[model samples]
Target: MIQLDQVTVRFRIPHERIPTFQEYAIRWLQRRGVRYSNFNALNNLSFSVDQGETVGVIGPNGAGKSTLLKVIAQVIRPTQGRVRLRGRVAPLLELGAGFDYEMTGRENVFLNGAVLGFSRRDMARRLDRIVDFSGIGDFIDAPVRTYSSGMVARLGFAVATDVQPEVLIIDEVLAVGDAHFQQKSAARIRKFRQSGSTILVVSHNPASIKALCNRVLWLERGVIRLVGPVEQVMQQYAPDAPSPFSK
Candidate 1:
């Protein structure tokens, strides 16, 4: 359902101090003073997820796990190579990604749904369920800026999982909720998996990855370190330990 071919995402980050716009402009005119270093967030990474596979992405910090997810979700374009997705993708990459802080939670739900390509009628039908699942209760009418981080996570998870997406891309945001809500969210995700959605999740928590994914993709420094069944890959990723899945 998802394919990435030689996907290389590069960023030209400033190597020297050119903090202000005026300094940058002056340096640009000089051409000699300005310097940039190429940082490859993803380097010729290629992977594919079949129609009903649950793939876990595990990596250390700065390993480009989140970048890989953003690429699959089309939040950012690859500097080189191609990505093909055959079905609808629900990306819970960032909680409250499309929300307007000034808008009420009720309004932001519709706004986020619209960003996800849902029609007004569609969001209207799912609105009550989303609110109920979120457990924001009376606070649903309050501006989103007033909501706590956990509250935002609940709302985002509820809305994103409300629809049965053909492909589900989840980042590590699921851990932001309380333990009770985390269990609730995991149960909901299990239901989605049972229905045959292709799922790609990025998590530092090994148990979460092991529990949810059949196959694991281990990335390090923007490259694929290993890809295989969860047990084998996790064994290599974390060696000779009792709690190999521990973060």
Candidate 2:
């Protein structure tokens, strides 16, 4: 289960004229002509995902969909309000996010597992399955830096979903990789849903959202535009929702 109450995430961005850090610091220290603007990536957002519920987040660019996921994923802390989560979260927020490019794919697997709070033996037991699911073949033993973006995506998804997490947070990284791999990953997500895992997914692919989510949250410019049944919200969000190919 997950809950967010009056959550807000803000970022202070400096003006383009203050290009260098030194210049920005000087102006700040002088307390004269300091130029910066606050951008709220998430504005007083509140929502709850019940146990075994699958929620889809859809929005246009800069709509704060990813920010919502990151907040739930605990990658981004809210500047106001509170978030409570009562489950182990496996977050596939960004491909290769916790990876060490210089490390071998095999090494990164263990590293990621450790980051996910798995013991050495636990990772060892799951290693083979993760590798097989990723379908990275001989590349698994090579440095991650040598991998293509698709390869990284495959590995990241495999490792993140290997464990039976209580909550799964998936960002748009699933949109990467080949079609075959995407289907494989989607199938795995379906399995998770069937097994009653709570899932929060952010995707531009309308069809994927429709297939995986019973409820959809539509966000626009850091605000919640709508939240309800998938079809209802999607219809209001994009009446003639573009086809998957357009995504």
Residues forming the 10-long window of minimal summed lDDT in candidate 2 = 15-24
lDDT scores of the candidates, listed in order: 0.90, 0.87
Per-residue lDDT over 53-133 for candidate 2, one digit per residue giving the tens place of the 0 to 100 score: 999999889999888888888888999989999879988887666899999999999998888778989989999999999
TM-score of the candidate numbered 2? 0.89
RMSD of each: 2.5, 2.5
Clashing pairs in 2: none
In terms of lDDT, model 1 sits at 0.90
* Model 1, residue pairs in steric clash: none
Cα-lDDT of candidate 2? 0.87
lDDT of 2 at 55: 95
lDDT of 1 by residue, 1-247 (tens): 8999999999889887755888877877888566789999999999999999999999899999999999999989999999999889999887777899899999999998898888999999999999998989999999999999899989988888898899999887657589889889988889889899999999877777888999999999999999999999988887654565578
Q: Which candidate is the best by lDDT?
A: 1
